[model samples]
Every structure is written in C-alpha cells, then in structure tokens.
Target: MLITLGRRYLRPYAPAIGVLLVLQLLQTLASLYLPSLNADIIDDGVVVGDIGFIWRTGGWMLAVSLGQVACAIGAVVLGARAATSFGRDLRHDLFDAVQTFSAREVGQFGAPSLITRTTNDVQQIQMVLLMGFTIMVMAPIMAVGGVIMALRQDVELSALLLVVVPVLAVVMGLLLWRMLPYFRAMQGRIDAINGVLREQITGLRVVRAFVREQREIERFGEANTALFETSLGAGKLMALAFPAVMLVMNASSVAVLWFGAQQIDRGAMQVGSLTAFLSYLMQILMAVMMSTMMVMMVPRAAVAANRVVAVLDTQSSVVEPTTPVPLASVNDGDGPRGVLRFDDVEFRYPGADEPVLAGVAFEAVPGTVTAVIGSTGAGKTTLLGLVPRLFDATGGTVSVDGVDVRSFAQADLASLMGLVPQKAFLFSGTIASNLRYGRPDATDDELWAALEIAQARDFVEELADGLEAPVTQGGTTFSGGQRQRLAIARAVVRRPRIYLFDDSFSALDYATDARLRAALAPRTADATVLVVAQRVATIRDADQILVLEHGRIVGRGTHAELLASNATYQEIVTSQMSLEEAA
Candidate 1:
C-alpha cells in the first residue's frame, strides 16, 4: 500500500526523486572508495616511508570526504521536500474526496477516523518517504560496493562475510516479522484513542452535568492503555533487533582479527589488507542497519497508506448529473423563482428495517411559508435534507423552480438556497466573518441588517467590537439562543431565494422568536420559506402546515383547519397550549 500511494502521489516530484538518487549514488561511491585509499596509504606510504604518496592520497581522501558530505546534505534536503509535498497532495485529495461524500458516506467513515487518516496516517507515510530517501536509497549501493572492495583487499578474508552477513539478516528479519502485527494494531489503537478523546472533549459539559467524569476518564484510560501495549510490543522487538545486530557485528570483528592474525603470521595477508577488510565489513553491517531502520518504519506506514487509499477509493452515493441543467437556466420566465416541490419523496438509511421518510410530498411557492410540525423522531430533518442533496431521496424527486434539485450542480443548487441547520455552529472568528461565511463578499452593512432581522443586532452591538466581536469554536462562548440567532443571521445574509430553517428558532424565547419571524416576513416576502419545528406556536402562522407522524404527513392545512380537523395536530397543539389559546 505504501508503494501504491507513493507512485500515485509522488509522480509530480519525479525530478526531485531523480536528483536525490544521483546524490545518494555519488555519496555511497565516495564512502566505499575511502577505505581503499586508507589501505593504499598504509601499504605504500607508511611501509616505504614515502611522504609524497601519503600527502597526495590524504588530499584525495579529504576531497572525497567533502564531496560525500555535500551530496549527503543535498539528498536529505530533496528527500524532505519531496516527502512533505507528497503528504500535502495526499491530504488535499483526501479532503476533496470527503467534500464530495454525502452524509451517508461520512457516517460510514466516522469523522474521527477520517481526521486520523488525513493527519496521523499521512504523517506516517511522509516520515517513511523521508527516511527512504536518506537511508534506503544508499543501503543497497553501500552493501554491494563494500563486498567488492572487501574482495579487492583479500578474497580469503572476505569469506567470513558469508556466515556473518546471513546471521545478521536472519536475526533482523525475524524481529521485524514479529513487529508487523503490532505495528498494524498500533495504528488502529491510535484511531480508537482519537475517537474516545474527541467524544470526551465535545461532550465535556454533558459529562459534568451527569457527573460521569470518572467513567469518561476510565474510558479514555482504556483506549490509552491499548495504544501503550501495542507500542510497547513493537518497541520490545525493535530493542531486540539492534542488540542482535551489534552482537553479530562485534563477534564478526573479533573473528576477522583472530583469523587475519594467523594469515599475517603465515605471510598470506598484510596488516594494511586486514585493516581495509575490517573497514569494508563494518560498512556492510552499517548499510544493513540503515536498511533495517527504513524497513522498521514500513509496516506502520503501509497500514496508514491502506486507510488513506480506502477513503480516496470510496465514491459518494450522491453524484452530480452528467448533463446538468444550470440552476438559473431552469427558472427563465417560468413563473416565480424559489418554487420547492416534493413528489412522493422517501428516504431509508442503509441496512434499516424501515424508511425514515416515506410517501412524503409538499410544495411551497414564492411569497409563501411552508411549515412542517412533527413529534420527535418524525423524520422532519431527513425530509429537509433531501432538498439540498445532503441525502438524496430513495424513491422520488425534490424540485426547485420547476427543475429537479439533483439535475442542478450542487454548488449552483446551494447558491439558490440558504440552510440554517438544527445545531447552530460557528467557526472561531469575528461576528462579521461568521455571518459572511455563506457570502464572503457581504459588506458590514449587510451583516448588520441580517443580524437585525434575526433579533441578534442588540447583543452584537453591545459587544466591544460590534460586528467584529470574536466567536469561539462551536460558538460555545455564546448562549444557545445567541448562537442560533447568529446562524440565522448568516443564512439571512446570503439572500438566497429558498430558505430552509430546520428548527432554527427553537433556542429563542417566544417573544424573540415572534419578533424575528415578523421581521423576516417582509425581507422574505418574494422568496420561499420552509420551517421544520417541534413547537406548534412557531409554525401556527404558516400559509401551509404539514403535521408528520411516523415518516408520513398525517395532516396538512392551515393551523386552525388542522386543529379542528386532525386529531394528531390537536394532540400536539393541546400538549403545548390551552385549547382556547390554540384556537
């Protein structure tokens, strides 16, 4: 999986990779030639007392050492650049793929897992790439060149490499094999830890409210312990590997000395040849160590690569039309803009026993407000989701301005509508920035106007910076009603033809809600409004009221008509208000 991702994402850095390879090659050749030069200086200069030969050879060695340092620096710099860029591209593609995914797809790969794949997983592969360029690229060349240079020193002494090299290889290979499964488990444990931590942080208030702090701590501790055990298992194998390599390396050095001394006494090997041979042997073992280090990182990186690729490969269920009808082109002189229609629309979650929405239908034209009132779990939000293609209808169609919503580009569809979601969320920015989220070019005046209509102008004006006042993540610094009003103001600033408010006014008091609706009437007089509300009072004044029960529209009419004619509507109204007040 690491190789696959590298090939695909690192294609753009081919030139950097080429240059890096050349530098590594030059560096390894320089290192290999140095020991040979040392051997010559000892045999020719020291033995014969030739100072000129020693000076000339030492000069060459110094020059080669400098060149080797230069090349090593160049290779490492290039590798870091290429690897960092590879990670950037991988993260970019992952984010784009996720943007295209529908709610269903996002649900399948939870947000915590997706975040892990994009960040920690990408970092793993990136580190491996960096190490590969610096180490793996040089290992093979150093190992092969060392063997040839050792033979040049003395073929008889080089025979020891047969036993020593194989012993080190077998030991490192066995330890790495044992570490792979633990490495795989470590990545999974990281995801588990991330999920648990994210949940605890997001729900910290709830935890405190219910006094579950100890339980939450225990839950996080369990995840942390699992990660520690997996890491410790891998760490133990890594600890064993280095010692094993050193044991063979040290033992081999002893054997070369013991045997080379006998050969020297018998006049079969010189002191210079024995020294050069030992140098070459150490170089070979060091090359093995470098390769082992790179391989140790590969198992974890390979696991991360698989996770990243899985997200990139999975296609979204909601897709754009091959031949899209432009959102503007459809409404050309065809009655008023902002006509919304739902025709037998139905939605069912995958692997569900029943559909969340079934046989649901409604229409709201320009200058009209259509309100959907439903009990808890009546699928009000699901029905609203179909209009924006957050989830496509399973059985029927939702149209905007006499055209099917699916037939239009998602961006174009979004431009024609503004959605104020059930949970009001704000990015960490100033009030003006959050309001301008849907419309970036919106002026300060426009932001103030939207805030005024949402009954948020007073609070914003009271702040020291007015529209520039800061908003924290999730708008937690603000009260629930304040956040909801800010979100509503954001939608209002867009001036979209169709406005979908999915219980957006629930956080406000009755007086504030009534005042905001009254202010919105004139502003949205020529546009369409769809409100999904649990409170009967919030939607009692709508031009059309649809009461939903168990995934179907059980009643549809004006509030008064429904109160007199529908038992379900009456049951809801009576639960919230006196019969006299409801009338």
Candidate 2:
C-alpha cells in the first residue's frame, strides 16, 4: 500500500527525486572513498615518513570530506522538499476524495476514523517518505560499496562480513517481525482514542446533563491505556534492535582485530589494511542499521497507507453526471423555476432490509409552502436530503425546475436550493463570516435583511460586535435557538430559489417560531418552500401538507382539510394543540 500510494502521489516530483538520488550517490561514494584514502595515508604517507605524501593525501581527504558534506546537505534539502510536497499532494487528494463522498459513504467511515486517516495516517506515511528519501536511498549504496571497498583493502579479513552481516540481519529481522502486529494495533488504538475523544467533546453537554463525567473519563482512559500498551510493546522491540546490532558489531570488530593480528605476524595483512577493513565493516553495519530503522517504520506506514487508499478507492454512492444539464436551460421555461418534484421516489439505505422512503411523491411549486409532517422515524430528514442530492434516491427521480436533480451539475443544484439542516452546525468564525458562507459577496444590508427574516437581528444587534460576534466551533457559544436562527439567516443570504428547511424552527419558542415563519414567508413569497416540521402550528397554514407514516404519505391537504379528515394529521395536531387551539 505504501509503495502504491507513494508511486501515485510522488510520481509528479520525479525531477526532485532524481536530483536527490544523484546527491545520495555522490555522498555515498565520497563516504566509501574516505576509508580507502585513510589506508593509503597510513601505509604510504605516515609509515614511510613521507611528509609531502601525507599533506597531498590529507588535502585529497579534506576535499572528499567537504564534497561529502555538500552532497549530504543538498540531498537532505531536496529530500525534504519532495517529501513535504508529496504529503501536501496526498492530503489534497484525500480531502478531495472525501468531499466527493455522499452522507452514506461518510457514515460508513465514521467521522473520527476518517479524520484520523486524513491526518495521523497521512502523517505516518509522510514521515516514512521523508526518512526513506534521506536514509533508505543511501543504505544499500553504502552497504554494497563498503563491502567492495573492504575487499579491496584485504579479502581475507572481509570474510568476517559473512558471519557478521547475517547475525545482524537475523536479529533485526526477528524483532521487526514481532513489532509489525503491534504497530498495526497501535494505529487502531489511535483511531479508538480519537473516536472516544471526539464523542466526549461533541457530547460534552449531554454528558454533563447526565452526570457521566467519571464514566466518560474511564472510557477515555481505557482507550488511552490500550494505545499506551500497544506502543510499549512496539517500543520494546525497537529498543531491542539497537542493542542487538551493537552486540554483533562489537563482536565482529573484536574478531577482525584478533584474526588480523595473527595474519599480521604471518605478513598476510598490514595494520593500515586492518584499520581500513574495520572502518568499512562499521560502514556496512551502519548502513544495515539505517535500513533496519526504515524497516521498523514501514509496517506502521503500510497500515496507514492502506487506510488512506481505502478512502481514495471507495467510490461515492452519489455519482455526478458526466455532462450536466445547464442551469440556464433548466430554468428557461415559463413555468415556475423553483418547482421541486419528487416522482415515485424510493430510497433504502445500503444493506438495509426496508426502504426509508418508498413510493413517495410530492411537489413544492413556486409561490407556495409545502410542509411535510411525520412521526419521529418517518424519514422527513431523508426526504429533504434527496432534494439536495445529499443522497440520490435508489429509485425514481427528484427534479428541480422540471430537470432531474441527477442531471443538474452539483454546483448548479446547490446554487438553486438553500438547505438549513436539522442540526444547525456553524464553523468557527464570526457571525458575519458564517452568514456569508453561502454567498461571500453578500453585503451587510443583505445580511441584516436575512437576519430580520429569521428573527435573529435583535440578539445579534445586542452582541458587542453584532454581526462580527465570534462563534465557537459548532456554534457552541450560541444557544440552540440562536444557532438555528443563524443557520436560517445563512440560507436566506443565499436567496436560493428553493428553500428546504428540515425542521429548522424546532429550537425556537412558539411566538418566535410563528413570527420567524411570518417574516420568512414574505421574503420567500416568490420562491418554493418545503418545510419538514414536527410542530403542527408551524405548518398549519401551508398551501399543502403531507402527513407521512412508515415512509409513505398517508395524507395530503391544507392543515384545516387534514385536521378535518386525516386521522394521522389530527393525532399529531391534537398532540401538540387542543381542538380549540387548532380551531
């Protein structure tokens, strides 16, 4: 997975990667050449007391050292740039893929896990790329060159490499093999911790209301401890690797010296050659150690890469049209441009046995309010979702302006409809910023007009900064009613032709709700309005009302007509208001 992801994202930076490789090669060659020069300096210069030979050879060594340092610096700089660019591109592609996902796809990969994959998982792969470019690229070159150079110095002493290399390789290999599973577990544990933490933070109010502080604390602690234990297990294996490498390295050095001393007495090898051989051996072992370090990181990075690839590979359930119907063409007719029609719409969640909406049909024409009233699980929100193409219907067609929504360009569909979701979420920004989200160029006059229609102008005016009042994430700084009103204002600012309010007024008091709807009615008089509401009073005066039960419309009429003839509508009306109140 890591290799696959790297190939895809890093391919564009091939030029930079090429430069980095050349630099690494030059640096490794310089490193290998230095030890051979030292041997010559020892045997030819110092041993024979040749002053000019020492100075000349010494100058060459200095020049090689300088070249090595220069190449190393250049390689690191290029490697960093390529690695960082690769990470940036990977993140951008991942985010784009996620953006293409429909609500169903997002749900399949829970929010926390998706967040972890985009962030922490990407970071793991990024770190490996950075280190791999810097270290891994040079390890094999150094190892192979060191072996050839060591043979040049003395072939008999080079025999020590056969035993030393294998011992180090076997020891590090076993330890890394054991650590791989723990590394995989560590990423899973991280996802668990992120999930728990996100849930607690998002539901902090509910937790406080239920007095579950201690219980939540314990839950988070369990996830944290699990991560800690997994990391500790991986850490122990990592710790064991360095010591094992050192043990073999030191033992090999001792063997080389001992055997070389015997060979020296027999005139089979020189002291200078022994020293050069040991240096080459150290270089070889260091190269192996570098490779081993990268190997340790590879397992975790591979796991993370798989996760990132999963997100990138999974196709969004809602596929966009290859050739979208133009917005101008859709709205060209003399008929009401905001007309929304659902023709025999049927929707079932993936893998679900029953449909959420089945054989359902309705229309909200321009200059009219069409309300959907239903029991808690009647799929009111899901129905509204189809209008925005948040999730496409499994069967039938939903059209805006007599054009099937699937045929409309995503941006075109979005531009024509304004949706204020059931949950009024606001990003961390000023009130003005949030309101201007849908229409960035909307003027302050337009903003206030929308705020007035939503009945949010007064509270916003009372704030010290008014429209510039700071909003915390999810609008936690504001009350539910305030958030809902602001969300409504945001939609209003867009001035979209079709407005889908998914029980958007549920958070307000009865008086505020009535006043807001009354204020909203005039502003939206020329546009089509679809309201999904639990409160009968909120939609009592709609041009048409649809009462839903078990994913089918049980009744459709004006509020008075439904109240008089529809038992289901009457049950809902009477539950919320008395007969006198209804009258």
The whole-model lDDT of each prediction reads 0.93, 0.92
lDDT of 2 at 342: 93
- What does candidate 1 score on TM? 0.98
After superposing all C-alphas onto the true structure, candidate 1 shows an RMSD in angstroms of: 1.2
Residue 488 in candidate 2, Cα distance off native in Å: 0.6
Q: Each candidate: how many clashes?
A: 0, 0
Per-prediction TM-score to the true structure, in the order listed: 0.98, 0.98
Q: Kindly report which residue stretches of model 1 are placed more than 4 angstroms away from their true locations once superposed.
A: none
Writing each residue's lDDT as its tens digit, candidate 1 over 309-373 gives: 99999988889999999765776885798999999988999889999999998899999999999
Model 2 TM-score, all chains together: 0.98
Instruction: Name the lDDT value of residue 118 in candidate 2.
Output: 88
- Could you give candidate 2's per-residue lDDT for residues 204-272 as a string of tens digits? 999999999999999999999999999999888888888888999999999999998998899988778
